[model samples]
Target: MFGKKEFAMSVHHRSARFLHHHPVAQVLTVFSFWLIGEALVRVLGNPLPGGIVGLGLLLVLLAMRRISTLSMRRGAGWFLSDMLLFFVPAVLAVLDHPELFGLTGLKILFVILASTALVMLATAFTVDRCWKYLGDRKEREHA
Candidate 1:
């Protein structure tokens, strides 16, 4: 018999409480990871990516509980759900690279195909593990 207000308050309370407790540390930690990601990309002359390292660093924090699931939950969940939208800008670059596509398109296609496969596999594995971990946590909550 819970009303909408109760549901909303509960959600708001969780999000607020998480933000309140570790606001500064969370910001610093994320900033550090992203900075590392940026530095890795620039210093290493990354062909594939740079921001991925920062993401892995954040993943490490999640595993260690330096950041709680609730704290990361909101941002990561939102990002993953709408991540495609974020790629629009990158995709637009293809329009400017029409000549590259026309002349040596096969070479680019091969690289793209391989990289896409790798990325898909990696994302699947990560998402699967996270789902299982969360599922187990829910089961324990009920038990």
Candidate 2:
């Protein structure tokens, strides 16, 4: 639907004002996900869902020091900002499934509520423990 001039104009507009401003961060972000995402979708008929595989790939790259936090800051910030929007589509899709809340809906709802509560509790406990461990380590180091 887009014409060549429109596409070229958009490119010029974007190129005129660099996103995130940092070249390295932009490069890493683009290289780590956008480039890989395109390749995976093109080469592999069945590509993994967005963010999931990209995140795993990013983590692997970070672990290997192929991409550093400094080079990922701007891109990471952009991703964090847009992360919630990505979940909106899935939520909208679920809303289309009104039957999911039919006769067995109550039971399913109960299970989901309980499991969600359990996950929250577990997450809270884990966070508390991690903080405690880190605090203790800091104190010990200072001692």
Off by over 4 Å in 1: 1-32, 40-48, 97-143
Instruction: State candidate 1's TM-score.
Output: 0.41
The residue-level lDDT of candidate 1 at 13 comes to 76
By TM-score, who's the top model here?
2
The candidate scoring highest on lDDT is: 1
Model 2 is weakest, by summed lDDT over 10 consecutive residues, at 12-21
Query: In candidate 1, how many Å is residue 83 off?
Result: 1.5
Would you list the C-alpha lDDT of every candidate in the order shown?
A: 0.75, 0.73
- Shift in Å, residue 9, candidate 1: 26
In Å, residue 91's CA in model 1 sits off its true spot by: 2.8
Q: Mind sharing the TM-score for model 2? A: 0.49
lDDT of each residue in 24-66, candidate 2, tens digit only = 5464655569667656766776467654666777889889975
Alpha-carbon runs more than 4 Å astray in model 2 = 1-20, 23-28, 31-34, 37-57, 60-66, 120-143
